[model samples]
Target: MALAYFNGNIVDMDDPVIPIEERGHQFGDGVYEVIRFYQGKPFMMREHLERLYTSAKAIRLEIGKQQNELETLMLELAAKSGLENADLYMQATRGVAPRNHLFPKCPASISITVKPSRELPQDVRKQGVQVVLLPDERWQNCYIKSLNLLPNILAKQEAFEQGCFEAVLVRDGFIMEGSSTNMFIVKDGKVQTTPLSNYILAGITRLAVKRIAEELQVPFVEKPFTPEELLQADEVFLTSTTSEVLAVTSADGRQIGSGCPGPVTRKLYEHFQLKVK
Candidate 1:
């Protein structure tokens, strides 16, 4: 069985009992980060933690543990789990309390679970995948990685039922992002994606991809593009902590460009591999 760290205690996943009264359970009052590791070294761990703390602060939730302490504990959990290639899912929730809809005096409750990493399907990487357009029905504070994910969950379910890789969310006719990943499109050899705003999560992989684009001398732009623009783009893709860089060959069953992973997407994917290696 995998190992889990709950409130500073490491235990088997099957036995890490969480109390029913935890505020996160009742009200989704929490923030989380998922750290991916390669060859036992976490990739961009500091960036992920920084975002996690930022999310917590935005929600007015106090993460009592210092950054150093959290880092040491995460490394220890990784070592104890003996997972060379894994994903560390960490979450901090407001403490247990009666259902009051208000902050309580209880300390924050932290949990971390270690699981083996699952690579994106090779077929999708090589041939690219299809996505569906969905309405962006999330809250205004998506920039904060809070645990209120009902909207995201519903969108993901819609995508799964449609046999698509992701749901590209649209708001006010402009493409915002995916349910679980960030979206990018290439038009006339220029790369464009939604800018960093409350509309989308500022993804770490998105930053890494931008750097790779710069290193490769690929033209990069960050601005809002409509759903029609996205559909007509020469190429499209999504990025996330787990998915890394993925090409979208089609949306709503319509082919994109030549119906394959475009040159810019391939180039970024290659450079991303080199970066992580």
Candidate 2:
């Protein structure tokens, strides 16, 4: 049976006793983070937890457990789940409260779950994936990894309907990022991605990729690029906890650089694989 860490207790996956009036359920007053674990050890767990704390603070939610305590609970839960490779999902909510919009007076409730790891399909990794461009209708505070994600959900659904793997959100004709991933482009043999602003989520994998590019002496640019520029890029890719480094072959029916993963993309992908290993 899959074991889960719920409300400070390790129990069967089905035994999580979330209260009916949980603020996360009623008002989406919560934040979450997913950390990838390889060979039973989480990668960049400190960065993930730091981001989680930042998100919680942004929403005025306080975690009941300290950072070290949460990390211990996560590791213990992963061991109990019996997964050598997995994703640890941690969330903190404002706890159970009456059906009201005001902030709850109680401390937040923390929960964690371990799930089997998922990797990008081999074909996608080799040939690159396709994406559709959609308008960015999310709230202004996109930096916080909040639980309210209706706009993202709808955009991803639209991409799925069009036989695409992800959606590239366009705001004011500029490409922000994928619905759940950070977008990058290669032009003139230089790597480029959007700046860390309220327009996009500051992705941990994205930061790692930037570091890798710098170490390899590759030119990296963190500037805003439009969807038109993204289409014209010699190579387009995305970074996320699960997607890792995946090339994009097409966007909005336009072929990107012979409609295949370019040489630079392949090089970076190989380099990223070594890091994960």
Candidate 3:
């Protein structure tokens, strides 16, 4: 049975004690972080937790415990759940409130769950997946990993309806990123991605990719590129916590780079695997 950390206590998954008035439920006032674990050890845990702290501060939600305590609890929870490889998700909400938008006087509530890790479909990783472009319709503070995700959810649903795996959000014809992942493109043997900004999430995997690119000596540029540029690029990819690196083969039913994962993508994919090992 999976164990969860709730309000400083480890509890069974079936517990129903979370108050209905919890601010997270009533107003979506919370922040979260997803950390990947390998062999019972969380990969890049420090980085994830750092971002979690930043997110919480952005929303003025204070965690009751220190960073070290949270890290210890996370490892303990993973061990107690007997998870060797998984995703550890932790969230903090502004606590229960009286159904009002006003700030509550209570302390924040912390919840953590560890679930079995899921790998991306092998075919999609190898053959690449399709994506559709949508206008960026999200709030300006997207850099914070908050719980208000309705816009992102709707965009993802739209992508699914269009028979695509993801949506690349465009603002003023410039491709910002996918609804839930960082976007990258390769042109003329050079790699490019949007600079970290309020328009997109500064993904941990995206930073890792930059390191990999530098080590591999691949030319990289952190400049904005347009959707049309992506459509004509020799290779396109997306990065996230779950999806280390994925190629984009088609956009709006149009073929991309011979309609297959390009060589540069394969090289990066291989390097990504080695880094995770």
Candidate 4:
């Protein structure tokens, strides 16, 4: 039996009931954060919370709670879950409202749920995983971690049907990011990724990878790279809260470099693991 925080009350995970007219359900009007815990301690928690607030602000959706209060509630829920490794998922929506395109005047409703953590398959880390390229058809505010994600869902499903682990999204021929992760490329011993922009989500793991690269003396450059360049790179990888650092061995049936997780990716993953610990 796990615990959940809903509308300022702690309740059984399976007991809390969300109203049918909740705006998050009726209109996808919300922002969310997924924080990972290692050894029962949250990693980059401040960063995640900051991003959560940023997303909420971007949507003009108030979280209705102070940052400290939210953090305390999340940690309490994590302790109640009793999972050494788990994910803290919190979402703030515009509250229950009648269906309308206009913004609601009600205060936001917040919910926090804790669940078991997910680790990338050992085979993926050992042999790398395949990805396919898809056109970026999402809305302009990709930076917001809003509940609206139809395009991302469709693209990820398409990639799954094509036997790929993830979908590398392209905008005007340049690779922006993965469906649920940030894309990276290594060429000529230099690592490159898209810069922080409205085109993609600024993933927390992506920031950690950059910091690890800096500490390890890896040349980490932030710039846009085309889909052609991504396919031709010596190595490719993706980063996300759940995926961590994942190597992309092939794209669209084409082998990248030696068709394996290259040395650079391996080194980054190693350092990232140590950082999390």
By lDDT, is 1 or 2 better?
Answer: 1
| TM-score to native of every candidate shown | 0.98, 0.97, 0.96, 0.97
Better of 1 and 3 by lDDT: 1
Segments in model 2 whose C-alpha atoms lie over 4 Å from true places: none
* Ranking of all candidate structures by their lDDT, best first: 1, 4, 3, 2
Q: Cα lDDT of model 1 overall? A: 0.92
lDDT of each: 0.92, 0.89, 0.89, 0.91
Give lDDT tens digits, candidate 1, residues 225-268.
99889889999999999999999999998999899999989989
User: Backbone clashes in each candidate structure, one number apiece?
Assistant: 0, 0, 0, 0
Of candidates 2 and 1, the better by TM-score: 1
lDDT of 4 by residue, 1-277 (tens): 3567789888777784888899999989999999999989999999999999999999998888899988888888898889989988899999988888899888899988888898877987999999999999999889999999999999999999999999999998788999999999999999999999998999999999998999888999999999889989999999999989989999999999999899999999988889878
Judge candidate 4 against the unseen true structure and give its global Cα lDDT, from 0 to 1.
0.91
How much does candidate 1 score in TM-score? Answer: 0.98
Q: What lDDT is reached at residue 162 by model 4? A: 99
TM-score of 2: 0.97
Model 1: CA > 4 A from native: none
- For model 3, give the 10-residue run with minimal summed lDDT: 1-10
